[model samples]
Target: MLVLLPPSETKHPGGDGPPLDLGALSTPELTGVRTELVEALVELAGDVPGARAALGVSARQDGEIARNAELRTSATLPVLDRYTGVLYDALDVASLTRAQRARADARLAVGSALFGLVRGGDRIPAYRLSAGSALPGLPTLRAIWRPALEPVLAAEPGLVVDLRSGAYAALAPVAGAVTVQVLSERPDGTRSVVSHFNKATKGRLARLLATTTGEPADVVGLRRLLRRAGLHVEHAGGTALTLVEPAI
Candidate 1:
């Protein structure tokens, strides 16, 4: 008989509010956090040597691919124009070498970690974190939000952006408070995980979305936007909205 494991849940303690008290975090502590995050990302890549190359694809490029595919296959254009800019920028910088690609990957990994931490209600000094300097014309790791987040926002405008840094800061956050559940699906089945965010963070994100798109950051509005962009929105648990797609 095949054994099935129970659904697993992990909750990270939320961080404090902004002007984040890094006082308790020593240099070594920060370094340790960064190192651990990088290692975890590398492991997540799961690309064994001589197996397959990890393209270190930029989030911006990924967003572009999604947007372009929508344009070709769907009847309407993406309601969010920023997606086009991100896609073009990603295409322009796709020729970097492996070493440069690694740097970009590192930034992306770190940026993701920061975002996760903030979403969990931690007070993070986003600018202080060493995501490294911007690569001139190249898109930064924060661009991941476009592809990873925009679809979700388009589906559930109620979801909020807690902390925005790097390229993400330029985009507005969505309004309202909503729960986010990240899920991983394998050959066997699917598993879901929950993400934590405080009310303040939700407010910040909603304000960003409202400002950027000139649209109300609500579930109905987001769903309309996403559907117009040729994306499918899945509503689960009545309140949770998920954007269905292949692993990012």
Candidate 2:
């Protein structure tokens, strides 16, 4: 199965890999849009204030704008290693066994506003675009990405678990892709979507699915696996699966 993750707004700085190369990324079909978005970002970087407004970043994050300016020439890191935030922290890739890591490398990928879809091993420089950010001189990111990215995701052969947030998911909605929602069940029998902690929960769940020996062919198997892992899972209709955790 191909497990799709959302790109973290935060990233770890610096890497030893060569500079960004659009052609070197996985999903070669996306190179055209990738180049377009990357060039647009680089061009936008020329005006730091303009870029700051466009990217919705504070003056304190001017350094991030610099990262965008240097995207093409900057050193790169593997897609998985580059993104750093609560979700990635919970994924805890550093502790995985070698074989598990291999499984992760093969099964994991991230949805990016700047790069579209990047596999775990794809090396890319740090970039600051978010799914909601509107780059000047281009169509909405949804318009730019949906036509190019949706089909690529739609074509994946195995089960696809999309762990992206709603904005990111709008860039491309894979047909038949299984979506997961984390909810917390209360003692009073009330339930609601968990916010902050669920990203970490999703991370741990993604790690579980990626490292395990068996692959889930469909949503049924996927739910079975999550249940086996001691999660309280239930079908939320259509292609959606809900994971319930006890309320804190």
TM-score of each: 0.25, 0.97
Candidate 1 C-alpha lDDT tens digits along 1-248:
00001111111122233323423322222443434333333343343221122222354334322322222122321111111222223222245455543332222111232232222112332211123323223344345334443333344323332223323433323334333333434455664432322222222232223323334355566556646655445655443555443232
> What TM-score does candidate 2 get on C-alpha atoms?
0.97
List model 2 lDDT by residue over 169-230, tens digit each: 99999889899988888999998876677898899998998899998999999999999999
The whole-model C-alpha lDDT of candidate 2 against the native structure comes to: 0.91
Question: Model 2: which residue pairs collide?
Answer: none
Cα-lDDT of candidate 1: 0.31
Instruction: State each model's CA lDDT, in order.
Output: 0.31, 0.91
Error of 1 at 102 (Å): 30
Question: Which regions of candidate 1 are displaced past 4 Å?
Answer: 1-176, 182-214, 237-239
